[model samples]
Target: MKRYTDADTYDNKIPSVVTIGTFDGVHIGHKKIIEQLVEAAMQNNLESVILTFFPHPRMVLQKDTNIKLINTIDERIQILEKTGLDNLVIHPFTKAFSRLSAGEYVEKMLVEKLNVRHVIIGYDHRFGRNRNSNIIDLASYGIQNDFTVEEISKQDIDNVAVSSTKIREALLDGDITKANVYLGYNFMLTGKIVRGKELGRTLEYPTANLHIKENYKLIPKKGVYIVKSEIENKTCYGMMNIGNNPTVNGTHQTIETHFFDASFNLYDRKIQIEMLKRIRDEKKFDSVEDLKMAMQQDENFSREYINSIL
Candidate 1:
């Protein structure tokens, strides 16, 4: 798929079929929209495109807000690419851009620049200054401007509508099992391995620590989990810890993983960990021996869980 940092990059090309949204989590609902978009693009012989923003508008609009994002831009891009879209346009959502009137934005960015032949938007989607523009307004503009406007109905599963906010709530509460049901896949975190205190090695359970990106990603509640770790593009069974080591009097929350029966110097290596199940809450053991024993139990459970699942 072609990725464009700005719509102007496609200035000389014909307008494509475009869908605009934050697509933050790329949840099941977003997948439905993308599927419809691909179908629309195929019918019209137009390139499928996704238009999303950076810094998440809420982060910009509310400086003191406590909004934790579910996916980083890179992660969002990876998920979008999997949707089979032909192009992705990442727009910088600055205050100035937000000030554009609905019509002005469509005229300049969408109509003129992107050559957007068919614009697909959610039925309740809004944009422009104060978000005064709704699908009805956008459809009117499209009618006047000679472009087709497709308003997709909101998707609901089992009578529950899927949304980014609900998914975030589920994740924040450590309900990954529920979140994954909505997300249609396990929630994953990808990062480069970093050096830790080698506590795992000392305990005979060598681990790789991840240095996660600070923005647009949220760790699950402090706990141990069964996970599948990916290194060198290969997946392996593993156990993960997400917490501040209370037993060691350490106060930094981190993601540490131990690949079952696999050992190598993984420092600075990129890895993706797909969280599978929450094992238990982070606890403070009485001593190093106690911690090691607990970790052994965790590892055993993790291996069993992976075996049962696959």
Candidate 2:
């Protein structure tokens, strides 16, 4: 798939069938819509395009910084590439861009920049200045702009909304299994490995500290989880802890993983970890010995679960 940083960067000669949204998780419901989009493009002999935005509209317009997303922009790109999309445009969402009139957005971004022959959008999607326009307005604009508009059914839109909300809630609650069911894939945390206090080394469970740069990426609840990562092209299973070290009197939260049998220099190297199952919530053990014993039990449980799956 060809990716453009912005809609203006695209200079497509072929007409396109387009879908516009944040597509946060690209969960099962979102995949259903993307499947339809690809099929529509194939049947119509048009390019399949997805136009998404960064910084999230809420983050820009409302200054709502607490909104966490399922995937970072790069991660979203990674996931979307596996889909059968022809083009992907990530536009910058800014206050000025949000001020555009509905007519201007349709004519310029959709019709001219995208060369859109058809648009697949949500039934209740709103756009333009002050968010006054709806799908009905989009249809009218499509008629004027010489394109067609396809409204994603209300039922499908509802499913998408529910799925997004549920996935976010599941992640925040550390319900990895439930979230993965809705996502159609494991929930991943991709980030750079940074330096920690090296406290885990003394515990005989050396760890790689994962530091995610994106503040908007949602982190699962404070707990230990079964996880897997591809390091040096080899799949490694591990147990990960996402929490502050209560027994050690640590204040800041951390994401630390101890791969079962894999060893390599990981500091400063970036990696992606996919959560497989929730093990247990972080606990404030009575002593370092107790904490070590708990971790040993977690490792045993993780190994058994991993073996069962294998």
Candidate 3:
């Protein structure tokens, strides 16, 4: 798929069948919209286009508020690319772009610039200044501009509509099993291995510490989890600890993973860790020996659980 940053880079003459939204998490609902876009584009022999923005609009509008993103811009692009779309447009949103009226935006971006034959959007989707655009407004504009506006209704999983907020709540509560059910896959973190204090080695269970670079990515709550770690593209069973090591009086929070039946110099290497299940809450042990015993049990449980499942 071609990634176009703006109209100047989008030199294709192919009529675009476009879908526009934040597409946060790329959850089931977003999947439905993309699937419909793909089928519609294929049926009409049009190019599939996705229009998203860098630095989520809300983050720009609400500066002081804490805005945690479900996926980074790079992550969102990766997900959209896998959906078989022909063009992915990441418009650089600015103050002037945000100030455009709804009608002006539709006329310029949808009708003239993109040459959109058919535009697909979610039922609750909105655009332009003060968030005034709605499905009816889009349809009216579409009628005037000689184009089509399609609204995709929400998709539900187990009577609950799949949403980014719900997934965030699940992760905040350390309910990754339920979160994965909503996300349609395991939650993963990819980062480079960094040097950490030599604490785990003292306990006989050496760990590779990860330094995540994606600022918007959310980390799960404090706990240990059964995980699958890919080091140099080789997957291995592992146990991950996500918390401050209270047992050793550590002050900094850490994400440490120990791979089962694998050993390598992981320093400076990139790794991707897929969280499978939360094993137990992080706690302080009575002594170093007590912490060592607990670590043994955690390792054994993680190995057996991952072996049975995989």
Best by TM-score: 2
Top candidate, metric lDDT: 2
For model 3, name the residue pairs that clash: none
TM-score of each: 0.93, 0.99, 0.92
lDDT, each prediction:
0.82, 0.95, 0.82
Across 8-34, the per-residue lDDT of candidate 3 in tens digits comes to 578558888888877767777677668
Clashes of 2: 0
Q: List the residue pairs that clash in candidate 1.
A: 15-115
Give the alpha carbon lDDT tens digit for every residue of 164-201 in model 2: 99999999899999999999999999999999999999
Question: Runs in model 3 with CA error above 4 Å?
Answer: 154-161
Which runs of model 2 end up more than 4 angstroms from their true locations?
Answer: none
Candidate 1 local Cα displacement, residue 101, angstroms? 1.7
66 Cα displacement, candidate 3 (Å): 1.9
Residues 1-310, candidate 1: write the lDDT tens digits: 7787877776437558888877777888778878988999898888788888777788787773566778878888888878888888888878888899998999988888778889987777888899998988888888988888886766532222446767888877888888888888889888989988888878998888989865558778889988886656577888888888899888788789888877667888777788889889999999989999999999888878888988
C-alpha lDDT of candidate 1 relative to the true structure = 0.82
